[model samples]
Target: MLFNSAESQTVNIYLDDSSTPAYSVAGCGRQNDNRGTVVLTSGKTGTVLVGVCSGENACALMSQAIDISPPSDNSCVGVVASSTAGGDTNSAYVILTWKATS
Candidate 1:
């Protein structure tokens, strides 16, 4: 994410559930644009929290949730459980018809 302010301020980035900030960057947007980024290790999943603070007075401008999911192998497409195709039956078939146009 990117942040910018008319006045000078301090930027902070916190990781996971910790109150302590993992990164603290100086200077505000009017002087220069600040960018924040984080990387998740293998086998990490579920909801994570990210927060941004702006200005010299130290006010929290934004908070966001980051969700992580396991990587896919691309073997097959997954289907939603709640969808239906008209009516259900013991067997189903898909048919295709094509006609040639002169």
Candidate 2:
């Protein structure tokens, strides 16, 4: 989402329908630095909302919702840690540490 103001502002990103912001960015402006992104990984269906405001006022200059769905079962996503024999870190096979829920 875009922050329309020229001055540095605070951008809030909310997940689902909660009143509190899940993430907040300070000192943001309308220039190339205004853009931001948040990763949604609740493992459930929900909507992402973004609110941009400036200064002491809590008003939102712009707000919108982005719908999100659960990730597909066929998708492969995880963290991998590897190490070679004799505690050697030169080479090792990559491993997927995250297990599938379903």
Candidate 3:
């Protein structure tokens, strides 16, 4: 994540229809140590929700449904998730990359 503002941002990741986040991080924009691994069955689709906040207000939010279809010969694939916050003037960005092990 790219942090431009003085205050750090919080990021939360939710899978499916769960009300609680599957993963969460505080002060995420300040460092590069934020990372996690999730396993999903191949040949299936799932919804992912990502939310970013600074204090009591929300800075960014995104939700997308992804299909996990690995090659017949490959056991893993790379996936990248990206989003931006704080609008045009003072925007911050979050990027997440991981290897999908199906």
Candidate 4:
């Protein structure tokens, strides 16, 4: 899902990776605060791809690397928004795709 729109606002998307879901991230961006990309691998092993777009107030977009190792069977993750220099207000979006890798 690629979430995009208001640059000054903030939105949160919940994830359930209890079954270990593989993924390819793109689109869904962030603003104001950092974005959280959680990858849960319980009973299976998977991955998460995150795309942090640029917001209005923020000077730039969030491009961070979030990964998992050892093939997690159970875990969680949270990517905080990147602190930009200038305070503009040009919102952005992010995209995420999860698939069971059992």
Tell me, by lDDT, which candidate is best.
3
What lDDT is reached at residue 17 by model 1?
A: 60
TM-scores of the models, in the order given: 0.36, 0.42, 0.48, 0.27
| Residue pairs in candidate 1 whose N, alpha carbon or C atoms collide under 3 angstroms | none
List per-prediction Cα lDDT, in the order shown: 0.32, 0.41, 0.50, 0.37
* Lowest-sum lDDT 10-residue window in model 2: 89-98
Which runs of model 1 end up more than 4 angstroms from their true locations? 31-47, 56-102
Reference-based lDDT, residue 27, model 3? 57
Model 2: what TM-score?
A: 0.42
lDDT per residue, candidate 2, 17-99, as tens digits? 77888777666333343244445444254455555444554442322222224644333322111222234221111111122
Q: Could you give the candidate ranking by TM-score, starting with the highest?
A: 3, 2, 1, 4
- Residue 60 error for model 1, in Å? 5.5
Measured on C-alpha atoms, candidate 3 has an lDDT of 0.50
Per-residue lDDT of model 1, residues 1-102, tens digit only: 233344433444454565766555554343224244444321132223333333324343322222324533322211111111234211111111112123
Candidate 4: where are CA atoms >4 Å away? 1-45, 56-73, 85-102
Quantify how close model 2 is to the true structure by its C-alpha RMSD in Å: 17.8
Question: How many Å off is the CA of 57 in candidate 1?
Answer: 3.7
